[model samples]
Target: MAITPPSNRLWWKEPIHGIELGWIVIAFLWGLFMFFFMIAWHFIGEQNLSTETYKVKPERYQERVEAFAAEFQAQDADGQPLEENGVPVVRPPVGGDAYILARLWEFWPILELKKGESYRIHLSSADWQHGFSLQPTNINISVHPGYEHVVTLTPTGTGDFGIVCNEFCGVGHHTMTGRIRVVE
Candidate 1:
């Protein structure tokens, strides 16, 4: 069709069709409803992102994680060291603090926890930002250097939960993975 303007000079002031106006109003109301729903969900939703964070030196955080791991290092059934990918397996006491330090290509000190018990999990990064993604349960969060993010978690099931770094950090990002083993 040839490009042309409405013959009437006052076409810009013409009233919109009733059907078109109704659709516009419906879309506007839907957007408003969704915007308010997100705010309300923060108060009533079961799965909510935690906002508890503290500023800390990455070096200091690393030291704390190392000490925590050393205190609760686990041993194998045959009296050998229990490890995952060369990282010691630590079993923190129930209702205690569990530290996870993320670095270039690994999360140090594999964690072992008891099912149905809560833990204050502290996560931080040593060098750069990383993603704390707990598989199966799908608790994903960002871990940044010099910031300790605390999240209270109680494992509802027992198994080996994989922690994958969803945020790419470096060339070895693909090899960055950790483990959390929960027992009954």
Candidate 2:
């Protein structure tokens, strides 16, 4: 029997050639493209994260929420108490901060913003974790207790958008549907 040289090496260690080499270069280029694409998408994208964020105590948050409710009790030319399903609707001033409180089976003080105007939305949970999903526009934010999730958005259209809780908080999760109205 003829003795052969030892050739115990991993497949990857073997010299790549022809189509394999082309694939390797293609994969490297694809990775580089994705790296820069994600950076721009996160930083310069419309769905970018808001840089301003802060912690909020639940009690003080509730107090602010109550005050906000009372402040907007008077309605505009459209309607008074601008509400649906008995949830108080808030039509915040143009280019201002809006707050949405998330608790069990409810997003209290439904929001109403103006079209072509920007809004800084402050979201927080009263009890457990919740997901703030704005449908049609497809914006989802995490609502955490004792912490606030802030997002800045401009309403491009005038319509009523739906808010659904995606996080499984308890048995009442299915009932946690809120509404946001955007007016022209």
Candidate 3:
């Protein structure tokens, strides 16, 4: 004789059993609710995470220099031709090291800035090509030799911003990294 479990009893084995059907229905509804809730939350939260567009160009720094020189010359008392060394200084709002130069596999000193202050970064490669990428904000800019690239950043929050090289230079390319500390 074969042994039969209590669950195989007539009452429990019936396909129309109210309790079993109720439980199945309840589980299906709960799963549907959870799936919809997750999708709704994702769509709602992603709206607040938009990013601003930034450009990377070889002529940006040169353009900025020319614009500043023109502006200063216009304001000069004698309207003299703009001298390269006499370009008016536009100090970074956060006031740390404003210019940084580095080689293919190295980074200059890290920068620290305050929230809501404008920072002007003048970057140029000493040797080969390199890329400047600021993470969490996802700003990827390129740096090349013989051309200085200018980037302006205003930290919206207080945290550490990572700088990574996205270019494939020679050996030690994986070790190229830097950081920007944003203080409150």
Candidate 4:
């Protein structure tokens, strides 16, 4: 009986030296392309999106309130008046200007508002960019120097909400604080 030796397999069929290398290279290039594509999308697509900055003046609040009230009144006679959580909505004086002279380490009079009443706050920085933060609930916002920031707030419960500056402004940035009283 004669014994025959087995022939070596082709490079394409061999376990470690086959077409697997080509597949690996293709996978690696595809992964690189995907990574770069994602990076490009992040830079190009995200850069075009606009951030909203709401500005308000002392006089605009009254005008807006009156407009809102008029709209509310025109809706229905027997319908509920914008009451949230069973609390009546209180509208501030219509078409009246409330002056807020921005100062360091102080918040003019500090507001006391009724629960469920929508209050519009017209904020602007006189000196520099200031961070307005209402605490416990942790509502933090930014006000640019010479630019106005308008925010509407309605407290759900009766409590003392502290308004603190979260941004570094000047020497008294740490001492800058205020309070909002939410009544029954």
| Per-model TM values vs. the true structure | 0.91, 0.79, 0.49, 0.49
lDDT of 1 at 155: 92
lDDT of 4 at 33: 100
Writing each residue's lDDT as its tens digit, candidate 2 over 79-181 gives: 6566667778777777787888999989988887888999888888888999999998778878888988788889899989999999998999999989888
Predictions: Cα RMSD each: 2.0, 4.9, 11.5, 14.7
Error of 3 at 100 (Å): 2.3
Per-residue alpha-carbon lDDT of candidate 3 for residues 97-128, written as tens digits (9 for 90 to 100): 25544465765545556798877676766677
- Scored by lDDT, the top model is 1
Consecutive 10-residue window with the lowest summed lDDT within model 4 = 92-101
Residue 147 of candidate 3: its Cα lDDT? 65
lDDT of each: 0.93, 0.84, 0.63, 0.59
Alpha-carbon RMSD, candidate 3: 11.5
Candidate 3: regions farther than 4 A off:
1-97
Against the true structure, candidate 3 reaches a TM-score of 0.49
Per-residue lDDT tens digits for candidate 4, residues 122-155, read: 6666566788777887567776655555556667
Arranged by lDDT with the best first, the candidates are 1, 2, 3, 4
Clash pairs detected, candidate 2: none
How big is the RMSD of model 4? 14.7
For candidate 1, lDDT tens digit of each residue in 1-184?
4389677768779899999999999999999999999999989987886789999999999999999998899988897878866799999999999999999999887999999999999999999999999997869999999899999999999999999999999899999999999999
Q: For model 1, what is the C-alpha lDDT against the true structure?
A: 0.93
